[model samples]
Target: MIAQRKDDHVQLAVEQQQQHSGRNQFDDVSFVHHALAGIDRPDVRLATSFAGLSWQAPLYINAMTGGSEKTGIINRDLGIAARETGVPIASGSMSAYFKDPDCADTFSVLRKENPDGFVLANVNATASVDRARRAVDLIRADALQIHVNTVQETVMPEGDRSFSSWVPQIEKIAAGVDVPVIVKEVGFGLSRETVRLLESLGVRAADLGGRGGTDFARIENGRRPLGDYAFLHGWGQSTAACLLDAQDAPIPVLASGGVRHPLDVARALALGASGVGVSGTFLRTLLDDGVAALIARISTWLDQLAALLTLLGARTPADLSRCDLLINGELRDFCADRGIDPRPFARRSGGLDVPHEMTGSTR
Candidate 1:
C-alpha cells in the first residue's frame, strides 16, 4: 500500500507539472538593473553555505520520491544528476520505510548512486528521535529535513488528523539528531512566526517550501471520492513572499517551491535566501527528457546564475542581498499587510532615498 501510494505521488506530481500554468509571486519581483555593473561573469561565484554545509551551487535538487521500484528509478536518475552536477539531493519522506522495512533499499539508492555527494534524508515532523536517526543512517545524510505539512495532511484521504505533537516531536528530533536539522514545509510556505519557532528550537536552518510549486492539496484531493477542498488549492504564501517574511531570520533561510528557471533562483538569492531548492521543475525535465538532459540543464542554470550575478553587480550568492529589488503587484500588498517594509528591498544599495512613509519602519 505504501509503495503504491508513493508511485501515485510520483505520477500525480508529474501530471500536475505538465498542466501547471499561471504566474507565481516570483513574477511580482523585479531586479533594479545596473547598466554600469562592473562585475565580470568569470568573477561571479555561486558557492554558498547553508544548513551547516558548503554547497557548490546556491540551488539543490529538493526532496522528490522514493519507496517504490518506479520511484526508486527516479531517485537513481536524480542522484546521478546530483553526482554529475555537484548539487545536493534530498529523499522523499522516509515514513514509508518505517512502515515497510523491505522498502529500505528504495531510499538507500540515493546513497548508493551518489556515495560522496551531499544527501538529505527527509521525515515528517511527527517522527521520533530514533526514527530520525535511522533515516539519516539509511542515507548517510549530511543533513535532515523534517517537513511540516498540516495542509497536506488535512487534505490527504489517509493522512493523520492529530497535530498536537508536531512541535514537541520536532523539538526532540532536532535536539537528538546528530546532523543539522532543517525544518521544511512540503508545499506550503513558512511564515515568519513559524521560522521564529524553529529558531527557538535550535534548528540549524529552515526551508521555506512555499506555495507556487506542486500543489499537494490538489493532489491529495484528487484521491478523494468527491475531489473536494478545491478552495484550499491556493492556500499559503509563495516562495518569494516567504523569503520576504524571513528577512534577517536568525537561522539560514532556504527557498523552494515555484522556482521555474535560473532567474527565479537569482531572485530568491537577492531576496536573502542562502540556498534554493528545485523539485517539480527538475523532476519534469528528467521525466520528460533524460538524465543527460537534466544534467545539461542544471549546468546551464549555473552558468546563467553567474551571468545574472554579474549583471546585478553582485560577486557571490551572499552579495546578492545587497542588490536592489522592486516589489510590486500582490506581493507588495502582502508586505504592507504583513507589516514588512518593502522599501528596504528596493533601496538595498542605498543609492536612492526612501520617502518618510517608506522609511524602514514596519506597520
Candidate 2:
C-alpha cells in the first residue's frame, strides 16, 4: 500500500514537471516569421473551442489526481487554477472513488470548485464499463478519458498488466455515454495501429502521452528489483513520433507528454493536435508554490502562446494547424521508422500537412 501511494505521488510529480519546464522534445522547428505588416498582432484571435466547450486558449489541463488525501489539496489548487484560466481540466483516475466512497471528495472537489468550467473524468482502460460510467457521473464530466498504460503497469510493482482486450469495454462505455470519449496513453505513446483501433471504436479523441517527458519505467525502477529492467527506462516513443503517427487520424488528437511551454503548444498545434494537455508541469507548481503561482505561471504560458500564434501568422488554432514546421534529427528519424516520409519537410514540396494550430508557419 505504501508503494502504491508512492507510485501515485511520483506520477503526480511527473505531471508537475510537464506543466512547469515542459518536455522539450518538439519545439525545435522554427516558425517562419512574417515581416510584412498585413495583420496586427492584436487582430489575431487565439480563442478556440473543443468537445462543445470554449477555451481562452487551446491548451487543456490534463488528468492529474484523486487517489489519496494529499491529492485533495492538489486537486483543489488545480481546480482553482483551471477555473481562473478557463481551460478544461481532467481529473485523475476515479478508481479510488469507486473503491473508497469516502475518497470521492478528492475527485469531486474539482467540479465543485469550478461549477461552470469544463471537467473531464478519467478511468483506466482496464476498468469495467460500469466503473467508467460511474466515474463520468460522479464528476458530471464534460468528457471521459479512458487511459491505457500497459507498459507502465508492467513495470510498476502493483500495476495492471492486461493486454488489449479492453475494446469491448471501451465500446460499451462509449455507447453508453452521451459525452465524447477520449482514449489516452500514459507515457509509452500510441501507434498508428492503435489509433486506427481507437477510431474503429468510434472514439472521438486521442492524447498521445508520448515519451521523453516523464520516465515512468524509470520511476518504477526506483520501486524494486533494480537491474536489467532499469534499461527499460529508455524505452517508449517521443512526443514527436506519436504526433506523426496520429496525424491524419480519424479523430482529433490532444498532443501531450513532454510539452512544456507556449512554443511546445505551437509545435503540437501545427502538428495537428486540436489542443495540447499539460499535467506534469502544472502539478509541480500546485504541489510546490500553490494555486496562485500555478495560475500566474499558466497565464504567462498563455501569453507566450498568443505571441507565438501571432508570429506564425495564425489567426486561430485552426490556422496553427495549417502552418509548416521543419523537423530534423532524432524527431525526423523517429518519424521515418513509423513510415512517415520526412522528405516533405526536407524537399520543401509541402510534403507533410503539419497541423497548423500547433506549429508556426515556415513560409
Predicted structure with the largest lDDT when compared to the true one: 1
Candidate 1: tens digits of C-alpha lDDT, residues 170-239: 8899999999999889888999999999998878999999999999999888888999888889799999
Itemize residue pairs with steric clashes in candidate 1: none
lDDT of 2 at 324: 59
Per-residue CA lDDT of model 2 for 1-363, tens digit only, reads: 632563566564655354444425585555544454123578777677655556677888888778677787688888889999888899987877777888888899999999999899998876777788789888899899999877777887777767767888887788778789999887788887888888888788888888856666766666666544677875778777788777778777788888767788888888777888987777776777878999999889888888877766677877776565678777777777777876454333233344676467675
Top candidate when judged by TM-score against the true structure: 1
Q: Could you list the CA RMSD of all candidates, in the order they appear?
A: 5.9, 5.3
- In order, the Cα lDDT scores of the candidates are 0.91, 0.76
TM-score, every prediction: 0.95, 0.88
Q: What's the CA error at residue 39 for candidate 2, in Å?
A: 3.0
